[model samples]
Target: MAAKKPWRIIPRPLLETILNNHAQHHRVPQPLLLHGPRGVGKTTLILQRLLPDWNKGPHLTGYVDFAELMKGNLGTSPGPWASWSTCPQPRLSDCRKILEHCVESMVEKGVSAGTITSQQIFTTLNKWHGLTAALRHVLQSKSRASDRASPAALWERAVFAMSRECTTAEVGRILGFGENEKNGLSFEEASYMKESVAALKLAKKIIALQQGWRANAITHMNRTGLFSRTLTHSCTDWPCLLLEFLSQAAEIDHFQPKLVINNIEVLKHATVNSESTVSGPLYHDSLIWRIIALGANERCLPVILVTSDSYYSYEAFLEFGYMEIFISREVSVEGLLG
Candidate 1:
């Protein structure tokens, strides 16, 4: 066969790291960044090169074409959920589609691999009991509430169902949940708690993801995310759980896992909603926060965030504005020839 043309446009070392097993297995990548002008072959390299090889290599990739995700799910211009608030209170509406995509990707990988069993996956998720309860409570509460209820009404129910004061105040106090016996919850605490509670659930399929007829609840369900209530194990969020699942699945073949976010620019593509006017938190919930919390803070999963925008640096993040942080490792896709 003729020599591949991508070899000419891509750097040798980066290409080797992507395609080689020894390099990928040992190297703990810190959210690998590919930033350049729109036509510099970044997406070309991802779609045409790394993706093809990585699938069969000692690594698994959960690729999310976020631009398409936005258009298909939210329309060309998504409202409040698409952007972060200008003040301290972040618009967690940011994580909506991402959560769905992660679950879908997991199901796809599980079905395609056909090597691992639901029991093993269940074992993996069971370790993060808190996430399990969050999903269960979110789903159950939402199920119980009337569909005609307004968003405000639903939020009140979420606070009631998920809050310790509403569920188990004394027990929560023992678990260090309250400020003092005299007070219930400060406004800020109640807000953040409801935010976390509002973030519960990841589609009902999570309870019993099926591959086929032979793969029903009995044999192919990862019910670990629904088996508990109290936060006895690790109290993690959804992204952490998704990344954990990716790591666990890859480890089955002694490989690694990676997150490929194409067109990360879509993250900033928000149509301003009414909440943008309020005094929001200084910082916003970030895609990078999700990755770093798991990659550097917890495990060693590599993430690839591709964007053409020059300003998506250190802390600029995909959606949240202006709180730029540092990404220690970066590679500019430069010197691509005609």
Candidate 2:
């Protein structure tokens, strides 16, 4: 038998094309769905090679496992529109905390894989601590006797205030800025705790928006007329937050943001459609398409949709011709990342 490779394998040309486009176009076409037979390794490449390196640049990087997201929703079990609930909205501080944890977790993996050093980890942790201190100081200095805001809300205000004080990228970079540009550190070696911290701070504002939308959706659930349309519009716009975050980072880093959506097939399962088609419950997919179209039009971020099965839909993503599909014959995480 031929010597078996260690990682999952993706088409070399497709990978090169993606990297090249990101370097030149400053944006990846949205819904660049990867279609292939089941067990072809599309999802493997996306999760390992693409998402990890994506926004870990000078600004922010985020990943949402669609399959996981879908599994969380009770509606996914009965087919589209069986039932739905607004996904839990996380606060900005909470977001940062999650990011920080992810990065720390990533670093541990990197070290085990011989990708980073102990000193690097400490430096990154210190940066996060410094930001936390700064945010606390800012919040205390601004508090007034009449102020009655909760601690979390006050922290959110302070984060925005901090955002306005420095260039957004600078703030973002502080949260997860790597020395790839000036210090010559590999992305893994760079400090990202700050970026995670910042994400936590930003989560507060995002939660408020989600809360309002959730309320509206619940209110109009009975009346499917104009309410359905309104509901779809609100939900569709949510992904734009990610787009905007990437775009702003591109400006700061002078590199287009590259994004990867892992486990695309799971989305079909995750999307909720209303049982009452006339009232047309919001489609889980509509939001995804909107995200792709907007990303392609803006051309600020390059997006890759990763899937494991060949069942692909053209109706949703035909406008962007830049998509490339890969089929995997062997299963190995090393090959995929390589």
Candidate 3:
């Protein structure tokens, strides 16, 4: 082998295209799809190059790897509905799982990876102190739960460590929040931690209602069906609370938001029908970016570049005669409409 290069190759054209699009587009920039052979440094280029540049810009940035999301179990097993063997439907539960996993990935990797530290994001949340009520509940619940060493547990610990304020009072004591990890977070780190913890807090709430996490909450929320639909985005145009958190954080920072979603191919495993009929020219991924992008203008949203990469990029390009794929997303929000 030639001298093993421990570095990544940035495709200059691709980088320039992404940069120009971000610079030019405002108010709901569409999704850009990347296509190439496997192991061709696509994901590497995104993490090593694209994310660094975006994080440095005036926008907030986050990276979600679908394959990694699929691998993590967020305090629950893959139920029959989500079991990969069944090729389950594209349910909100899967989306909820994804949102949860996305938070985990950001919180765990963001500081080290330096993808979520927008100067504006840091400025917006710098003065936030005290244990937010939602964070208190999440930490208290984790403190009370069994199996204190799972990945979920470790993630909770890490979040607690990152988010500790000056006073390690009652709630902080529950998770040892302010014991040893104070006086170290920079303004950027503090801002990212505030938003990330808030995102995680909201993700937990969504999961509670959407899934059977708390039977009583479901019992009451599902009884009305209206409350259920509102929480789960069944009848609402708003996307997941986590997505909202991302947008709101970026908006507060006054920077446009950019989300790099890798491996759309992994979503094939989570489709509604087990048939080979799902993947085609028209299958707009309704789960994640599509919902956020569609209502961008009406929502008074900043220009959020929600880019994903899959083989569909090439197929859509070939069919639509476009070099890069920027298409709308279509998802069903049918229930609780009454």
Model 3 lDDT tens row, 161-246: 44553233432332235656554657765555564543344344434433333345534554554333222333122233334434
TM-score for every candidate vs. truth? 0.48, 0.46, 0.43
Query: Candidate 3, 66: how far from true, in Å?
Result: 2.1
Error of 1 at 39 (Å): 0.9
Model 2: residues >4 Å from true position, as ranges?
1-24, 29-31, 47-63, 68-210, 222-227, 251-255, 271-283, 308-311, 317-338
- Model 2 global lDDT (CA atoms, 0 to 1): 0.41
- Each candidate's lDDT (Cα)? 0.44, 0.41, 0.40
Q: Give the alpha carbon lDDT tens digit for every residue of 185-231 in model 1.
A: 67775454433322222222333221121223312222332222112
CA shift of 262, model 1, Å: 1.3
What's the true lDDT of residue 74 in model 3? 29
Clashes per candidate, residues 3 or more apart or on different chains: 9, 29, 1
Q: Top model by TM-score, which number?
A: 1
Predicted model with the maximum lDDT: 1
Candidate 1's C-alpha runs over 4 A off are 1-23, 26-29, 69-95, 111-236, 252-255, 271-284, 314-338
